[model samples]
Target: MGMEHSILVRVITTIMPALVRKEIQDETDRITGKSKQISPIPIHLSIFSTNDIAQTPYYDFLILPVVNLTLIDLPGLTNVAVEGQPESVVKDIEKMVRTYIDKPNSIILAISPANQDIATSDAMKLSREVDPSGERTFGVLTKLDLMDKGTNALDVLEGRAYRLQHPWVGIVNRSQADINKNTGLSFARRREREYFATSPDYGHLASKMGSEYLAKLLSQHLESVIKAKIPGIILLINKGIDEMESELDHLGRPVAVDAGAQLYTILELCRAFDRIYKEHLDGGRPGGDRIYGVFDNQLPAALRKLPFDMHLSLQNVKKIVSEADGYQPHLIAPEQGYRRLIDGSLKYFRGPAEASVDEVNRVLKALVMESIRETEAMVSG
Candidate 1:
């Protein structure tokens, strides 16, 4: 059994992992015809010991109902080595959790028992290490009914305690007895709803409580994340198509073409490069404004920070004037000495100037790459 099955039983037991897209018109497409279907589904378990956390298995399941969410079912955090487990199991699990959470693109679902102290929660502790603002973390408090008779998790659910930018949800999960008797999730969910809807402590906010609400909340969150990334994905796809078309067109063209054709081809390539360059500088594209920022903000800022006073101090200026006027010093205006002093001081400006040029070059390269990925640069077809 996977690690998720344990906690998921108390939380999202009935809600199995789902497919991103589904088409069920043909039943034969889903089921195998025994001998004819030699290839099994892509789900596989590694041929390694279960105790080895590093040998984690992965699967690509063809599921229905189209939820489009994936969860990495990692092992629970441990305080010490159990009898059969490795001595470094606790550290190993913590390292594994951090590995997944450290990714900027991942969303963390931090679940903890409501009866325990939230301040000492291992899940939230690890989550905060990676996501200090709690932006990508969703806090789930399970076993709400397990708390003492006089105490409740009202402060946690309402955000008065251990406040987070993202909201927390409380769940009164089914007990061991309910699971042993094989009670349906619907009945457990009904009981959960009744507990919250009628409780003097939770009734005021019953609408936002229970497992059903949690499902809807997670669904909406996943949908919003997917929607946010769709535009960028489309841009990449279109850019790839444009690149392929251009490459094919170039390869198919004659190497021994007429002079007029060669000139036209050269003009076309130049025009394409020119248009892209202008659009970038004019802020007509997404990353276009960076070029202006490099010139206006960064270059000026770098120039201002140069040590002008140190470079042009009176003692240093005098030394340079003496070096310039060594043998044939200008008799009257001393133009050579003055020019030498000015040129020596100007040397300090070279460092910032070169640095600005390098920064601008890098920014232009990134801007040109992004412009090709923009809708305007992509092939229309």
Candidate 2:
């Protein structure tokens, strides 16, 4: 069976693997246990043998019925290659496990078989690296019945070595004989309780052994973690609410409180526009003088400063006539000719007038936008 089956079997009821229809079995056995009817045959099994991460959720009805918990059983960290896996596979799995354990919110559950050396286990070593102070890491010692005769993990369980904030918990997994006989998990749990209760070497530590006790301990630990983070969570929520309120204020509507107030604001804007228009037309200092004064006075002054002979030349008259009439000839009566010549004389000045009006209009638009911005700023403030 795969890790998914192992996990579900540990925490939930037994799920029988289908003997027929591999595809249907794979689809049906999701969450409970992945069907092994379609087992893959590879020349070599790497840490990424399946080339997928199994995200299994575990729920305990017997122990922490009211609380739900999720536990991840990562690939076993080992340099040994019983299945022809390369040595690099061990390192790759170590890196993957370290990435998850190093996260701030993670709680490390370092599971080491009691039959093995606790200090030498790769799982325990990795846990130490993530939790240097041993504050959040807990140990679960499995296969209590498999340990050699006259040997026990009492020292590790009692925290004499590999000390963690939460002491080690011991559990007994189902033996091969139990599995062959179709013995359920309840029997396995009862067997564990009995072994720890009667055995001279483990009876005193009965409170710390068995799956039920471990589940209850984990539930309590999670509750404490939630309680500890409540204040910080609340603080963040309040900060987000305040930020949203300020943003809403910043984008508030431009409408005034009442009709009279809105009318007054419109009138004030109209007056401002009128004042600016008059100022621009009159060559006031507020409007740059270049638009009106340069064409009106400077060109004439420069022309008058020229020598009298040069000023009276036909070329000069022709140039003025050409510039005024835009170089296009048109027949007219004497009276109309006088009016057309005057219009031509003022043709060069039309540019400045148009430019001045455009500038004033641009300034008025900017003032309106600024007033809106100021109103919004006041509301936000």
Candidate 3:
């Protein structure tokens, strides 16, 4: 019995994941403009273990694409009954459907009542309630063995058409005898099904647990897939300050009065800037050159006046690199852009003595934002 219950639980677990994947695929299609169908169906486990309804094994499952989200009222039929119960059932069914589907547009009621008379009253109340709203409600009542005969009988008495079929009538049905005969199930295999039948609640709880498990699995998979497709870019910049320290060590003039060494440092600095700029612009990095160009153009005229005669001081070189560091064009792209600009600007301008490099970086960031806004306007227009 335990083994049979395990097999049944496994089947539910396997099926629920597929259903969840289908829902995710449908949602993705709608977002990408490929499909118009939107399904309002809440992910749920169809509890087939209930004893009130005959257990009908499902052989095949059909996956549906996106469809408009619709409300579905599912009425549970047990022994409980009252004289004024039809209206209450109708209202409860409607509320349940709305909550389950989470859609206000279309509503469908799947009802199973104790008898034909009660089923008819329930259907009528459901139809009338939804009729004024101009939404169609389908009442599906299922029975065993007999298919269209029951539906036809109800149709004639109600003076309205009601489609009746077996619960698993739409699904391909096969008998246990047929399965056993075809597969040549041994004594051990037959015992499994018999064992599973003993534990009724096992199947029900497993189905609910399977649904929750699938929901979590699908959520995680979707998040991973999305993250893999879109990745963040990181850019690292380093000035050659370490190399200069080695050269200064060989010079005996307190590393300050060596004009030739200073000249070399300035040349190296200029080369580093040029290489970075060119790599960003012509190297085919995404948003690379466009971003680098903003900083390049924003260099102040006063900084450009620095002599390349190799006589510049350590203070000058430090000032140049510091100013360049402040240039952050990437921050001007959108909301992120504004935040980067504001942060960079505050950092560059907050001190009593502003470095020339910091001023240049701040101005460049502002210009980048302005340029982005203008470009956006042109595209939007």
Model 3 CA lDDT for position 332: 33
Q: Could you report the Cα RMSD, in angstroms, for every candidate shown?
A: 21.4, 10.3, 26.1
- Candidate 2, poorest ten consecutive residues by summed lDDT: 39-48
Residue pair clashes in candidate 2:
none
Off by over 4 Å in 3: 1-8, 11-94, 101-109, 112-120, 127-136, 141-381
Off by over 4 Å in 1: 1-67, 253-381
Models 1 onward score TM values of: 0.51, 0.64, 0.24
Ranking by lDDT: 1, 2, 3
> Could you say which candidate leads in TM-score?
2
Error of 1 at 125 (Å): 0.5
Tens digits of per-residue lDDT for model 3, 98-127: 454344433334343323553455444545
Cα deviation of 144, candidate 1, in Å: 1.1
Please, what are the lDDT tens digits per residue for candidate 1 over residues 1-381?
121111211111233212101121122234533212211122222222223233224633322232334556556777887655567767877877787789988988898899999998999999998999888998989988878999999889889888877788888887888866666778889999999999988898788888899889978887898899999999999999999989876555445379987898677656766676677778565555766677789878988887778767889777877778788776787677788767866787788778878987888788777655452333322
In angstroms, how far off is 376's CA in candidate 1? 29
The candidate scoring highest on lDDT is: 1
- Candidates in order have lDDT scores of 0.70, 0.65, 0.39
